[model samples]
Target: MTATPLIDPFQRTIDYLRVSVTDRCDFRCVYCMSENMTFLPKKELLTLEELDRMCSTFVGLGVKKLRITGGEPLVRRDIMTFFQRMSRHLDSGALRELTLTTNGSQLEKYADDLYAAGVRRINVSLDTLDDQKFADITRWGRLPQVMRGIDAAQKAGLRIKINAVALKGFNEDELFTMVDWCAERDMDLTFIEVMPMGDIGNENRLGQYWALSDLRDSLRERFTLTDLAERTGGPARYVRLEETGQKLGFITPLTHNFCESCNRVRLTCTGELYMCLGQEDMADLRKPLRDYPEDDRALENAIRAAIALKPKGHDFDYSRQKLDGQMPRHMSHTGG
Candidate 1:
């Protein structure tokens, strides 16, 4: 096999692609939706065939890692079929890692098939440990069931990772407790900085973008965090707590600009490829798919175009333009 040339906006070859299967989710998490948020029409979403073709083209273009995301990926009807087919493609070596990031509400029933299908890992978004708090934050708490999904994924032998967005008021109290939980089991606990992504001014207001560095500085006595080597996979910086052998990751997108080493491009649920979260500009991929029927040089060239256009980094992290009144499209939509 020949090497897929790496070419990113930062002069690095981009190899990561996050594909959003749908812009719809079952949960109405506070940060993700408004009291009156309307979902996208089914026809507006990328078809399974369109998605597979795009994934295959991008994989051929050197996207070694592909993450499936959704409003809730499993919320899509008959998602098992999608995974069964996608897994076969990923295993064929068009991609290196095929992973999914979900809310875990619907993973219990699908874990076995997903694992058997070739899905390599799972990242479950569970912010609060308290059931009521989880309910308050997610609106449809169902903490017990989500926990069940986590157990199911683990039992299925999926490389499970827990992603908790450490909101100052929501789950700030559980920061260390959560870390201890992951440390005890050696499961990776990732602290994702709440990003400004939507338009729900009141619900999505990022009033509490706490700095992880400060959180670490304050916890110097309890645990020592050692920085790990820089590698790009997800949007997090790696660090480990001393003596525990547990990985502690901080995705400080709001406070830190990690664009120099940025090597990712994203696909929206509607089949548009976004080069950066902050930029409104995107290449409308649905048109190309509608125009072309199969994976050809044109399709591969489009993937290359998207990769080559991958931004050096996002500038949205540091903009102080008062983010208390907006949320972009929700984490589920962008696969954050």
Candidate 2:
């Protein structure tokens, strides 16, 4: 039987999938979520078996790249075992790349195990280099611990990328320092413009949103950034450093919308398929997956129906809407 390929309304081939294993995290970054919050119950989250089945279905559909994300993925119990189970697909050439996006708190403990389980690429979230600033932003996170995790990942031979959320009053001063830090280690760094997601006190965070265009201009003063013809399956735009030979990326969803080239979809921990991060269009996959666990045809049809309904682009105009509605915009909940 011939399988149907999953293409969206924009004719973009959907080959990338970001799955949120859990919405729980150790650090509550100011830009991501508020300190006080409610998380989904364990029963509500998709089990390992269910996640494996869903991943297999996506792989069969046409997904080549799979990224395991979380509020913090490492915090999920026996997540390495889950990765090991999925690694079989990578070993069998069923999937092209298996990657993880983590908070780096538990990377030191799981880096080696993760590599052994077929995860070769990792993106660690590190906003400020300053310890005090880190604590201030994350409320109770320790910079030293995250630093050790990054070091451990490098030692484990994993390709590391530092993901920094660009906030105006917070980490703006450290942008150049971050570039130099990545260059010294021969690592790639990506700066993402803070999006108005969820109820993380948008009023307080509104002043912190920094545009990527301005950030690029700032980089030009210190270093010459040569545009690199590279696509990473996600929204980031890659560039090469003329002097240090290092690579830098920008994910400017707010200032510069890259929705036209958006080739990925986010699956929340609770099994909701979010077509766009900025919009409220989502398909409930948990009910379908749970209702028809033995019916692969039913599961596949549900996913295909959702993918067919993916919009051309997100309606994210900050000037008009503040994203203050009851929609789930929390990055943790949406598998950022």
- lDDT per residue, candidate 2, 1-336, as tens digits? 125778988798898999999998999888777888788878999998889988888888888899999999989988888899889889989799999999899989999999998888999889989999999989879999999999999999999999999888888899888998888897899999877777776445457778888999999998888998899899999988898888899998766778898889999998999998877889998887889878778878888899889987765545543543234478888877
lDDT score, candidate 1, position 147: 85
Compose the digit string of candidate 1's lDDT tens values, residues 286-307. Answer: 8778777853566666666776
User: By how many angstroms RMSD does model 1 differ from the true structure?
Assistant: 2.3
Q: Give the clashing pairs for model 1.
A: 6-13, 7-13, 24-71, 197-327, 197-328, 198-327, 198-328, 199-327, 201-325, 259-313
Span of 10 residues, lowest total lDDT, candidate 2: 319-328
Which regions in candidate 2 have their CA more than 4 angstroms from the true location?
319-328
Task: Please give the lDDT score at residue 280 for candidate 1.
Answer: 56
Candidate 1 segments whose C-alpha is farther than 4 A from its true place = 1-6, 230-232, 317-321, 324-328
Cα TM-score of candidate 2: 0.96
